[model samples]
Target chain A: MNRYSLNQATTKYWSLEDVVAASAKADLSWIGLWREPVQEYGVERSTKLVTDAGLRVSSLCRSGFFTSTDAAERQAKIEDNRRAIDEAAALGTDVLILVSGGLPSGSRDLDGARAMVRDGIAELAPYAQEAGVRLAIEPLHPMFCSDRCVVSSLGGALDLAEQFPVEQVGVVVDAYHLWWDADVYRQIERAGARICSYQVSDWVVPLPADTLLGRGMMGDGSIELRRLREACDAAGYDGPVEVEIFNQDLWNAPGQEVFDLALARYGEHVA
Target chain B: MNRYSLNQATTKYWSLEDVVAASAKADLSWIGLWREPVQEYGVERSTKLVTDAGLRVSSLCRSGFFTSTDAAERQAKIEDNRRAIDEAAALGTDVLILVSGGLPSGSRDLDGARAMVRDGIAELAPYAQEAGVRLAIEPLHPMFCSDRCVVSSLGGALDLAEQFPVEQVGVVVDAYHLWWDADVYRQIERAGARICSYQVSDWVVPLPADTLLGRGMMGDGSIELRRLREACDAAGYDGPVEVEIFNQDLWNAPGQEVFDLALARYGEHVA
Candidate 1:
């Protein structure tokens, strides 16, 4: 129970205040957050709310779209990521997840786009380390390879992460994005201390039209969540196991109900 | 155009006879066939029709669902694969593409299911070789890893194919399924003579409700078709390049129109 955290996206409809209140009332030790809501509610005010409620922030949702071909746009994205890192540091969380953007619009240069991801991360590594935050690269599923994230596998993420200091850059192992990989266990073992966050969500099929919102609640699909969590543990990751589902049905449900269901499912299927 | 083959699935609405006639009319030297339509139209009749029309059969669409958990069911699948090998030989095509089935129902044992695929292929290798048929393992995209095929990468397919003689087993390099893989080019180079089939299809975004029908025409989406074709050529695959798309819009369009577009796109984007 100490290791379980409800990511803000899982209860997306909940106000930041309500989620903090619910986590504290539920006697949870950690809560995961998203940048937009935290900024909307004022970063300092949101930080104080969680701190006063006796809850720790596990991680900030994301910050990385460094696949832009335009120099100015890419630089602006990097600057935005720096702000994200500072926000994560202010909230007292060391991890800021990154969903590297896909190929530049109207472009088919996959290798070039991936090179941009590596270069972008190289530029951000020093700034993140100084801010006491880690840029955790999250590999979206391959279906999103063209439009969402160029880094589509943990091995690819690690390839990028290994070029920098372990404290500076890390990889995220989200089950929804990675459970389909045959090499996942081996990659998890290789990840070792570089695994900054372990997010959980089920992969139900006949995926909804909007694949982004197709993630199922834990145990509702085919993922071996507990086994993955155990592999992460064996690989030296004892961080908060954040439940980060993005399903429309779950999002439409009451936040408290969804949060409670997530907690229960995590205990049964992932903890 | 000697290397161009029109896989019948791209013109799903066309009868086997119509596709054969169209391919011959278009001055194409090869045509790809699917099991259901070929079997439905009578394999011998279909074979003679294409043979007489001066069109050679490039490959057989599919024949492998070797991930069953039951002992009897596994044996039955192996027996069925033997029949498919005979059909391929009868059609005078050496390549019999296989889409290894997904995990068994109510099972999360991916490794176990994959082991079943290996064992089933092992059981069929000798029979296929004797029939002059090569089992071409087609690695479906990772999105289909849970429901369509366990072999989710060309590397994974090679890992299986290498266990048998090159004449008995080989791998299919389909652009739509493998374009997202960063290691695909290296795997293709390593494939060398193990590359039995080189398939081309573009990958469009906002995939439809049924992802199986989401493949775009050669020039309609994000894949680097010409580059992939060149890689295959460098890998010593001088065989037919099959245009295999499964778009709903294409299927709904006139078969001749779709066929003509595929031919034109192949010259522009793949050939």
Candidate 2:
């Protein structure tokens, strides 16, 4: 079955209550909740709303900005991730998506920053394993390599994942990020069953901004979503095709309208 | 010895005559000649002017954009690059830099575009080798992944190089493009003597524009030039440090003044 999951950020204009009601109204069987929304409604209430609506938590929004040189900061990040994992487990999310952060302050040594990320993940893997939530390391686009994430390739994420047990460490192949990678298909195959989630969003060829908020809607941009879906399906990833858009324009629209657009686009282009 | 080369675009306000005079006055050992300047001066006069000024050609400014999917278009690019190689040879350049082109039209398949680039390089390799010029693949910043070179990493370039004999393929580690790569040091080690040219420029964290024209001058931005030079030196790469800035503001300034600033920054920050 081709299931469509609405990542809450697409309609960030809505409150947690608003999103839950809208998700129920839209008849979306799956939804990805963010940290702020979960915190706002309290995890128990958020979990209850999902249960009541009969909606599955596709995955938690994120958990891993693990790129720090300081020991205390790194430990704090790991602890924060542990909380995120606990929340994912509570929400019955199968995966806790991780976005490895960028270079530490004043540190131009990229290799050193990457080692810190690996160590930070290694430190947190046991707790994630014990919590029953798969840690999905999402490789952000190379544009975010400096400020947002150092892990900018599926190959790099897989290299990091190889350090941990397969059940605990997996990768989220977000099309918007991995679409520009030359080895996407090969890496997707390499990821195989370890791909915890497959995400879809188009790469707006001419990015309007350099920050995180300029992502395009699934079909509005230039990415060949059908080909990406074919690759993911071929790789045995029979998961929800999560619609994750970080566009400011989409976020400003009404929740139901955004949800409807995503659903329509999914059916028309992605499915 | 630390050798300095002025990339003509850095002092774009100057004509070819002014650039040659400025280099002579600056006591700079070399200058990277661009196509526009060459065409303006006629290749014969351009080569003679540099020779008269006792300046060497470190490299020809560029020659690749090989992302066109059509065989004829791709072949035209190769032919253009061959002409560039001849230009480089006439000027006694050690390398003809190749800026591998962006995503082909109507295509989101980055791997396929990269394969086209590899084939383009393979076809151009013999022409370059026969002319006694090395083809240096300059991996652009990831921001350029879509509309520019899909080769966004030193590792990616090295991986491509492994497809051919080592002597024919090499990489240009431009600090602006590769300052944020996690595997830079390891890739540098892997590149070893294949590191044909080292270009320096700073990465302004929040890029002012999506285009390639806003590049920051060496000490004005975040890149650690001395440290990168140390890494290159440690990896047994003793090459001339070419200053390549693409700033509009700097380009508007007097050419001699820009050269003075670049030379001062090069000595203070890079030497």
Candidate 3:
């Protein structure tokens, strides 16, 4: 059966308890969580809450910001990722998502930064494999290429995955980052079975200022969700489709309202 | 010698004649005029003003919006591009820039749209080639991928160029669009003499709303102009670097002030 998971970032205004309660009320089967909330509630307590509520942990929000030119800084990021893997293991999460950070400060050496990303992922893959937490590389929107992720295309992420063992490194295909790509369908086909997670959101035209928080909710913007789902289905990916929106307007609304809206939209547009 | 050309979009408030006079007063070697102004002032009169001011027309502002799923609509776009090429030739400009339009309405077929773009360009290239004008593909910011140009990377543009005769298909390396790309340096090296125009501008962090119009002036944002210049220089591109900006605030200012600021910034940061 197709399932929907709420990425906690969608309703960041809500506390962990609020999210769990709302997820249970919304009858959602799965939930994707971020590290900050788990840390805030104490991982043990948060784990207990999800377990008590009978919600499956789909995946943890993130584990990588791996493009540091400095060796020490790069090593520290990898160490931090190892801890995130441990956290994912504790929560019995299936995947630990990774974001390739942008170019190091004051440097226009994009290839060098990409090399650093490859090295960083290679260093962390072994530990993630041992911990049973699949490392899923999330290619952010190309707008974030300068400060967030050097890996901006699914093909680019797949190219990076070639460096790792098959089961260890995979990709998180978020519609927001790739919906507009000319080669998306072909790349999704190429990413078959290697796609660790599927994330959905809409692309709002004339992007707002403070772009980080301006993401649109499902069906509220221009993405053809049905087509994207068809592509995912054809690609042999049966993972929980996670809803990850970062809209300021939605975030400011009541947590229950946001969850209800996500649930209704997911059923109408994606189910 | 390093020479500067002001892309009139930076000071959109100025009339074409006023912009030419301002360019002359600034002692700049060239000026880039837009289609609307040329139509408004009459192409012949604008040409004479540029000639009288001893200013060379660096390149025309734009020409292509090729991505249409509709056959007739797409053909109409090609016809429009033919006229744009004639205008560029009339102005004695070396390059007629092309921007591949975004996804067609109600279509999630990115590949289909790209095919339309390629076919459109192929149909239009002969006219440009015959007119002795180069059609430069300007890969816009990836943020514009949905509604603006689908071609968002230098590599992607170069790939498109490889499908056609080299002289008929070239690329405009706009720093604002290519600066964030991870493979920009290598792609620039690959572009080499195939680069028809080099556009310089900065990427301001925390961009304002109406992102299309919020482009920062040179040196006011984070882009490393000198590094890109060096890369282009190393790649054997000795073309005049054109300053193209689309800031609403700057556009609201007087033309003389805008040209002076562009010249000063180009000398201090770009030259």
Candidate 4:
């Protein structure tokens, strides 16, 4: 119970205040937040809301699009990430999830885009380290490789993370993104202490036309959620298990209903 | 031109006779065949038609749904695969592509499902070897991992292929399925002589309602088709480069138009 956290995205319609209050009411010790909601609520006010609710921020949703081909756009993104780092620090969360951007528009240079990601991280790691925030790379599923994140596997994410100090950069193990991988268990073991966050969501198929909103709730789909949670535990990660589903159906449901259902499913399938 | 083959699926609306005739008319030396159409045209007649057209069958499209949970069904699938091997031999193509089935219904044991695939192949490999047919594992993109092929990467395919004799088992390198993999180049190099088929299709996104039909024509999407073809060549794969797109738009277009365009694109981007 102490380790379970509700990522606000799971209940996308819920206000920051409402989610924080609901988490506090449910006696959850942690909550995961997104950059937009936190900024909308005013970062300091958002921090106070969580703090008053006695909830710690497990992680920030994301900050990374370092695959731009344009120099100015790339530099602007880097600066934006620095602000994200400061936000994570201000919220008192050590982990800021980084979704390495996809291929540059009209370019087929995957290797070059990946190199730019590495360079982006190298530049930001120092700043993140000083701010006491870890830039946790979240390897999205390969389905999103061309348009979303080029870092499409846990091993690939670890390869990028291992290039820097362990404290400065880490990886997130999101079951929704990685449950299909044959090498997932081995990579989880390899992640060790570098796994800063472990997010849970089932992967339902016949994915809607918008593949981004296709994630299922825990236990509702085919993923071995408990097995993955055990693997993360074996990897020396004792952090919050954040429930971060992004389903249109779940988002359309009442926020409280979705929140309560996520808690129940997590307890049954992921605890 | 001698190395270019047109997989019949790219022209799904075309009768097998039409595709083969078009391939022959275009001076193509090879044609890739699917089971249902060949079974429809009569395997003996289909073989003679290709032979009469002076076209050699590059490979047989499929046969391996070895992941059924039912004992009777599993046995039935193994027997069907034997027929498929005999069919491949009858068609005079040494390569029989295998799409390992998805997880059992209501099951989340991915490792167990993969093991079933291995066991199925093991039971059938000897028969395939006797028939002079090499079982080619086609690792689908991870998006299809749940409802389609459980074998989801070239590395995973190689891991299974290496367990058998090189002559008995090989892997298919389909650009649309494998281009997103970070370790693809290394895996291709490692595949070496274990490569039975190299299928080409670009991966266009905003994937349609039916994701299966989302493959784009060569040079129409994000894949580095020429780079991948070069890598396969470097790895000693001098076999037919089969153009195997599955886009709904292409299927609706005139077969001759699509066939000519595939040939032109192969020369421009994949050859």
- lDDT per residue, candidate 1, A128-206, as tens digits? 9999999999999999999999999998899889999999999999998988787899999999999999999998898
Fnat of every candidate, listed in order:
0.58, 0.41, 0.38, 0.76
Give all TM-scores, in the order shown: 0.98, 0.90, 0.87, 0.99
- The lowest-lDDT stretch of 10 consecutive residues in candidate 4 chain B is B19-28
DockQ of 1: 0.76
lDDT by residue (tens digit), candidate 2, A1-271: 2377888888888887777777777787888889877988899889999889978899998889988778889889999998999999999987999998987876666677778878878888888888888899998876677677888788889989988889989999888887765567888888888898888888775666546776887777667788888898899888887888888888887777887888888888788
TM-scores, chain B, all models: 0.99, 0.96, 0.97, 0.99
For model 3 chain A, the run of ten residues with the poorest summed lDDT = A103-112
**What lDDT does each candidate get?**
0.93, 0.83, 0.83, 0.94
The C-alpha stretches of model 3 lying farther than 4 A from their native spots are A21-28, A66-79, A104-112, A189-194, A224-236, A254-257, B25-28, B67-79, B105-107, B189-194, B230-236, B252-257, B267-271
Model 2 CA deviation exceeding 4 Å by range: A68-76, A233-236, B69-72, B163-167, B219-236, B252-257
Q: How do all the candidates rank in terms of DockQ, highest first?
A: 4, 1, 2, 3
What is the TM-score of candidate 4?
0.99
Residues A41-147, candidate 4: write the lDDT tens digits. Answer: 99999999999999999999889999989999999999999999999999999999999999999989999999999999999999999999999999999989999
Model 2, residue A164: C-alpha shift (Å): 2.4
lDDT of 4 by residue, B1-271 (tens): 8999999999999998899889888888999999999999999999999999999999998999899889999999999999999999999999999999998998899999999999999999999999999999999999999888999999999999999999999999999999988899999999999999999999888899999999998887899999999999999999999988888899899988998899999999987
Please say which candidate is ahead in DockQ: 1 or 2: 1
| lDDT (Cα, tens digit) per residue for candidate 3, span A1-271 | 2379999999998998989888887677889999998988988888899988989889998879987768889889988998899999888886999998987876656678778888888888888889998889988887787777878788889988878886899999898888766567888999887898888888876676688876788876657777877798899988799999988889889988888888888888887
lDDT of 3 by residue, B114-173 (tens): 778888888888878899888999988878877878887888888788798878989999
Candidate 2 C-alpha lDDT tens digits along B148-171: 888988888988877877678788
Q: Scoring each candidate complex against the real one, what DockQ results?
A: 0.76, 0.45, 0.40, 0.86
Question: Model 4's CAPRI class?
Answer: high
